[model samples]
Target chain A: MDIKDIMKPENMVYSKTPVLTSTTMHYCPGCSHGTVHKLIAEVIEEMGIQEKTIGISPVGCAVFAYNYVDIDWQQAAHGRAPALATATKRLHPEKYVFTYQGDGDLASIGTAEIMHACNRGENIVVIFINNGIYGMTGGQMAPTTLIGMKTATSPYGRDPKLHGMPLKITNLIAQLDGTCYVTRQAVHNAAAARKTKRAIRKAFENSALGKGTSFVEVVSTCNSGWKLSPVAANEWMVENMFPEYPMGDLKDR
Target chain B: MAEKILMKGNEAIAHAAIRCGCDGYFGYPITPQSEIMETLMEEQPWETTGMVVLQAESETSSINMLYGGASCGKKVMTSSSSPGLSLMCEGLSYLAGAELPCLVVNVVRGGPGLGTIQPGQGDYFQACKGGGHGDYRMIVLAPASAQEMYDFVDLSFELAFKYRNPAMILSDGVIGQMMEKVELRPMKPRWTNEEIIKSMPWATTGKTPDRKQNVITSLALDAAVHERLNHTLIAKYKQMEDEEVRFESVQCEDAEHVIVAYGCMARICESTIEMARKEGIKLGLLRPITLFPFPKKEINRLVPHLKSMMSVELSTGQMLEDVQLAVNGRIPVNFFGRLGGIVPSPEEVLEAFKNSINK
Candidate 1:
């Protein structure tokens, strides 16, 4: 085929969104961040608010998310992204603001900031990525880690008395008065990817309408952190992760 | 017309913030400084100046709000007392590391840990040194009067943006609570989005097709990169020390004795000079306005012209060490201060000065 033919609009399928840059992402293979980042980029591109979207990227494997998203970003310290989002959304109500946080960041260290931000009814979106382990810190047990999960910090498996139960943060947030929409999802396959994209789009749309806090929690898999093959990780996530964190809309308003 | 208001120092801070075109003010109520936010709540600047004022759940949330606003290239600030300021240290460190411009007013109270609600300059070491972790310095402004509190709000923001760094107004309980006449400046319109793009080109206002997306971050994983950032911060501090030293030298010319003080203590020492001079002691007062730049050079210049120096403070001689460093052993720098919220009178300061001179 000629070069011109390859560039033809009619031949195009699954081209990358302009909202994401050509820069290579730092996320590991089979890490959920890449899928989540793509969904956000596609949603922003689709909404035509690429110029008005501000992202607060938190500390974790996805801390360098700004490099790939190509949107204005404020890199927040560990769990402080929600606090940053609250201010950004309030100060510029005309703009769309969101925070991309990990399980360790959101459910653990930054619990207070996230809880208060959601409770304040700040018009913003929160995209929480949850795996069972802290990926950046070498597979440590996260607050969302499964009760019997074995990991670096929980060598003998998580004890209910010592580590506490895995936090159902989305359910917790759904109970708050300020959150307009809250849902749990995953991106294990092309079908799931499309569903997650729709969910993220809904979140962005809600923020644009000043609909308080809209959250889309992605129960993602970390193949490296979980010490499993990418295929096995997906299978394990379906069999094991789904029962604990079932993929469905928990709340919507 | 810009009307002069008889307002408390904290209230003047609120008035001046509204007039200074602050885009947002996030704070939590603390003793001696709750009036700062309370006044903003009463005035409701949203109706007039379009300023966003929020009473945060805690100082932690307030400082992070400041971080968010600062990242967006907006003028934002927060006010708190010593204990509250302690709670904000982590956020302050993050703000400094990111090189974000914002204002933090510390209406200092006595504290080892919530020691008293009354005024104290005990946080001098915390303010002058890096209050947070890492190698960084905030431009610490010591406002001794209600007028200074009013004036320094604009000045702190100016310095904050000029250097792309945090600036602080380190006032004490006396300065925060005292009522006095203040000349409120004319209102400045908040920066337009286009103006912000022009001024803070690196701020994360929004991403445009023509420009690379702005990322306001302080993280650097590489050792070399982190070291270079530290060097840049050190250079900025050096520049600040050179250009931003502010102090009031009262009667230092040919005086035999000098009294070094700042904030409310400086105001008290102003009267102490008069009392000391009457007793045939040629005493002068060196009041440091910008405590971080520290007026070191100016104080050094007066060393040869002074016989002895006495440092007066509300805390147990917290600022005396800086005075000694400025003197650099050229003269005897005696320390005299009241601990745990004791406000010293001019006579007490004079007595301390006389005792030092006699010794």
Candidate 2:
């Protein structure tokens, strides 16, 4: 058989989801945001809800998530995505609503909004990307920065007494009665990406069932912020990030 | 004629909003204005008219909630007092930059920092001037009576959607808490989902197959694009200035002096004008209904007929600056105000007007 003849539809194993637009992502090389964005687009496409999904983008690296995802989007102020999502979901109950936020956006300035939204049991999905550093405004210490981790702001390495401990926010979210599903996953490899995708799909499904807030915290890698190569970043996340944020479902109701 | 019913100013707003077919209301409780939401909760518009009413966690959340609801091309509104309105300035700027239409009601109370809960017009500058950090403007309506409070809700939303800008009802605690007989309008049906989708093509309802995805954001990274947006906004403001100036001229046909005022002070000036005319003072009142597109033209038109002018406000001469600018040294304009939530009586205003004439 010729090579041209072998390239047939039956030979096709996988393809890109059309839910994502042709806009080139602005994330740094080896960044996990692209992987997470791809997984969300795939999940939206698979569930056939692209026309009815509204995504709220935060003020971090994924602020342009709206550009890549071909869906209705609203960019919220720093730390106010949950409040926006709460209103959007309440007003349009038939539509699927989700918020994509970073560690700094959710854990620092917007703690009150997140805590109240989750407590109110809003029927929305929250996709939290925990990279342990602020990537958009240059590398700075995030609330989730690991102890002894070094960033531009934490040049002396993060000290527990000075910078406080890394916040395991997913664990706290799991305890909220409003949350029906809370999980922590990663995308360092193909297996991990597949697991994260499954978790995302379930979160969307829970939204359809009118279940209270579905939260998925993705333990992500920021190579540029971490000052590491792409391959080394993945290895470093597995060795360091995974130990602090274990890969499993904390609450699945 | 519509039947008249007595109600508080804040309660009249709640009734007017429902009658105007508003889609949602997100607000936090504040002094003298909590009755707006209290009435909505008591009425249960959610069960009857399908209106979504939610008490947000804070004013920050409430204003952002209005941003979200308005982004979907829905009729939404919020109400707050001075301190709460201060907290909402950031969100207000975002709403204006995004060009979203919604209604905001500020029942003014005394304020420098958590000032008295009594009636005061201290927020005149904040409302007509820049309350947020941007070069944007909101259509401000100052209502002196409960009837105007009831009537301005529909007008504000109509103007808001027409211009694609935010609108504010600048009232004081005296107007918000007082009781008066207001003629209520009939209930207008709420817009259906299909109606909203058709009317608001730019709304972020969804990314349907027939149209492009709608993105609501105030962020533009490119300098040229932001500048163009600013130019467009400026043009819209100019249009408002030309077309939306509203004021009431009370007995100004043949007068020697005019009293410039708005909101509750305008009402007080009515009494002052009565007292002054009885004493052969020849004083007439010019009440600005629209504070942003102020009655500057009317003030100038009456300048040749007047020898002097005076500005009466609950604050210490915030609106006086605008009056001075309008007069432009043509007339000797004076300001009379009482601070710290003390409302000047008609006698005090009449005495001040006489003092200006002597000067």
Candidate 3:
């Protein structure tokens, strides 16, 4: 059957789920955020949490995650999405709550909030999107920016001598007793995209079980910040960002 | 049923919160107000009453936790002193913007920065006015004694849920630390989760397609939409001023001088009023109970009869500005305050009142 035939309203097997709508995406060509968002929406739809989920949107380019994700949403103060998610989950223990944050927001200004939320073992999920550079702010050097990486803020190669070493938040959170599940995944390709969705699903399931804090960090590509074509950006993330940040689960239980 | 038990101010707040059927308490330990968390921790209300008690990493996290809890239509609260409350301002604004009902108690101390742990009304402006950004107002209740502390917890929670707005108990170091005779009431949950959800169907628990997906956001990208939300907020504030204005008046019938104060400072002002009365000064006390509504009408009423009004506070003349606005230049308004842990005694307040009246 043709693509249109399968996707047609009357012919579709799954009804239009509350977790996603038919609104046209605002993402650029080859942008991975759209794919990542869709994966999350699919998981919510399959798990039947669309009616009982609250998602926090951060201050980066994906600040409007609520627009695409059909669940209830609240926009958090810059760098404070983790704290917001922590509060939201603690108040409604039965509901599935998660925060969608970028590297700049999660690792820089909101570092304290994320660290403590994990330490407190708040039953919530944190979906961290680390693109190595600040996207919306014009390619600025971010906390996870690799050594020798060049950007608007760092005109020359990033020098570990000057700027601090890259932050591996998942590894750091794994040390905290409160964190029950901490994993670093990526969405550079179709295979990695599936894995990212599985990780997100696990994170949400942990919250439902009241297992404690669950964190999933996605090493994403920012074509605008990296100054690469969408295809090249995905390749760059796999070749450069993944090696330094690594992709694996740091904590299971 | 009648019940009475002598308790300290901090303990009274904890007991009153339990009686009010608050579902959660998120707070960090700070001086004077630490007893509030301490009492709750010892009482272990979580096991008995299903109350959720969490000692957050800091005041910032505590307030955000309150935000999370309140979003679910739960009766939630967080308590701290001046410095901690300052850290909570950001979350406070978000909560107000979201229009969630929650209780925040500030046991104030002297400060521009980390001033002192002593009792002071330095947070008068921060509490009475919107402490955070945006055009919003909290339901501010100022308690002068331990008894009022116990009573206002229930009252604050009632007002919070009634309006679906954040309410504050603006207490001070003296009131928080002082021991006093207080009556503890029996425990009762005012509204169950189902009741609260039924009342606020718009709350962000989840999205049911039957209802339009509810978004609990303060952000309105469109200028007209943003402005409309602001207008609605202002109208609500005006209504709150009309409905929630509360204060206590003493010897103001045919009085020549009036002393305006609130929280612990109001208690001191009461003693000053007594001493001034003994010295034949004919000074009256106007103690503001709801500091946000500020009893402005009462002040306006006194402006015609009184020669002058003097404001006594533990801050550097913060509430005096409101007093001036209320007087509307009809009568002179003077201010006397002690900052940075310095608390003016009753005699000192009396002296200030006498001097202001003489002037």
Candidate 4:
């Protein structure tokens, strides 16, 4: 088949799933948020939970998760998406609720909320995007920034002596008895993307089964913040970020 | 039949919340207001009525948990003291922005930081004005007595659900720690799950393909859209002021001195009014029940007849500003308050009223 024919509307197999819409995403060219969003959308579609899913959008770069995910969406306060998700799930115990948060939101200001929610065994899903630096705020040092990661706020590289160690949310939440599933996955390559999708699905499934809190920490790339081309950013994330963050389940039940 | 039972103000509020069919109770233990959580925890309304009760790790978690429940169209609540309430401000703002119906009880103590765990009305401005951010207001109900504490829980829930806004019962340490005779009402569910879901179509439960997708967001990126949203919120606030403004006037119809007070201070002001009446001084009291709506019309009406108005509070003259605005310089407004847990007595208030009248 010709390339033109493959791109034609008649030849294309369009998904009629309620979870994914045709809306154009606002992500940067090399941003991994789109891929993560798509995977979440696909999972909601596959599970036939489009009409029974509620998503909480965080404050950072992915603050617009509501626009992409064709489900009931609520915009949470900065670093309060976990709390919002906890509220949404408890109120509608029959419905599936999840939150999409970034490193700055989840690991920093929102730490108390997420930790307590997990500790209380709140039946909800939390999708934490850990990109090491603050994306929307112009590459500031995040709580999850690597030891030598240099950003606007940590120009001389993140010093453990000065700024504390990088937070491993998956490991932290895994220790909590309330969390039934905890995983850290990357979305740098196609293989990693598939595993990240699986992690997202498992997180939602765990919540659906009333298995308490399920947390997925996705190691994503911020090309604009990293000051790299789309391809190079993915390569850099795979080489420098993934080994430190790791890609595996910390806890599963 | 208006039967009375002795109860602590916090306990009264807890009983009232359970009676009002509050579906979820999320809170962390805090001084003075801890009884509210203790009552719920011991009562275990969840076992009987399927209420979801969770003792959160912190005030921040509790408020957020309330946020989650509210988003699902559930009648949820959280109670805390001054310092704990401060931590919940961010979540409170989100609840208000999302227009979620929830009850937040702040049994206020003295504060700027962790000031004291004693009774004080320091949070008057925080509760009446926007506590968090954005142009938003909470339906602030000030309960002056144990009876009102019990009654106001239902009122707060009704107002919260009716307005699609967060409602707060602003009590104080005096009320929370003190016990009084309160009439308990039969428990009745105000709304079924179906009714609640039907009432809040905008709530983020889930979306079906057959219906238009609903987004509950505070963000309006465009300047024009943002302004329009703010305008809509302002209109709602105006409507609340018009329709829900509540206050109680005692002997104000034929008095020379009017005392403007609310919450615990208002209760004390009532006694002062009685004492002044016995002493042959023409004195009356104006007790605001809804602090945000503020009973401005009542204050304006009383201003023409008043020789002087003394605003009494448990804090350093916060509500006095509102009283001044209401009087609009038509009458002299004086302020009397005891900050950091020193509640002004009726004698002190009477003395202040006497001084204001002499001036």
Candidate 3: Cα lDDT at B177: 83
lDDT of 4: 0.86
How good is the docking of model 1, by CAPRI class? high
User: For model 2, how does the per-residue alpha-carbon lDDT over A1-253 read when each residue is reduced to its tens digit?
Assistant: 8999988999999888889888988998899999999999999999999989999999989989989999999999888899888888888999999999999999887888888899888999999999999989899999999999999999999999998999998898888899999999999899999999999999999999988999999999999999999999999999999999898999999
The candidate, 1 or 4, that scores higher on lDDT is 1
lDDT of 1 by residue, B268-292 (tens): 9999999878888888988999999
Where in model 4 is the C-alpha error above 4 Å?
A1-18
* TM-score winner between candidates 2 and 4: 2
Candidate 1 lDDT for residue B240: 99
B181-227 per-residue lDDT for model 2 (tens digits):
99999888888889989998888898999888899998889999999
How well is each residue in A91-122 modelled by candidate 1, as lDDT tens digits? 88899999999999999999998998999888
Candidate 3 residue-wise lDDT at B230 = 84
Over B295-329, each residue of candidate 3 has an lDDT whose tens digit, in order, gives 98888888888889988888789999999998888
Q: Give the Cα-based TM-score of candidate 4 against the true structure.
A: 0.95
Stronger candidate by TM-score (2 vs 3): 2
Worst 10 residues of 1 chain A by lDDT: A5-14
* Decreasing DockQ order of the candidates: 1, 2, 4, 3
Model 4's chain B yields a TM-score of 0.96
DockQ comparisons of all candidates to the true complex: 0.85, 0.84, 0.68, 0.70
Per-candidate total of colliding backbone pairs? 0, 0, 2, 3
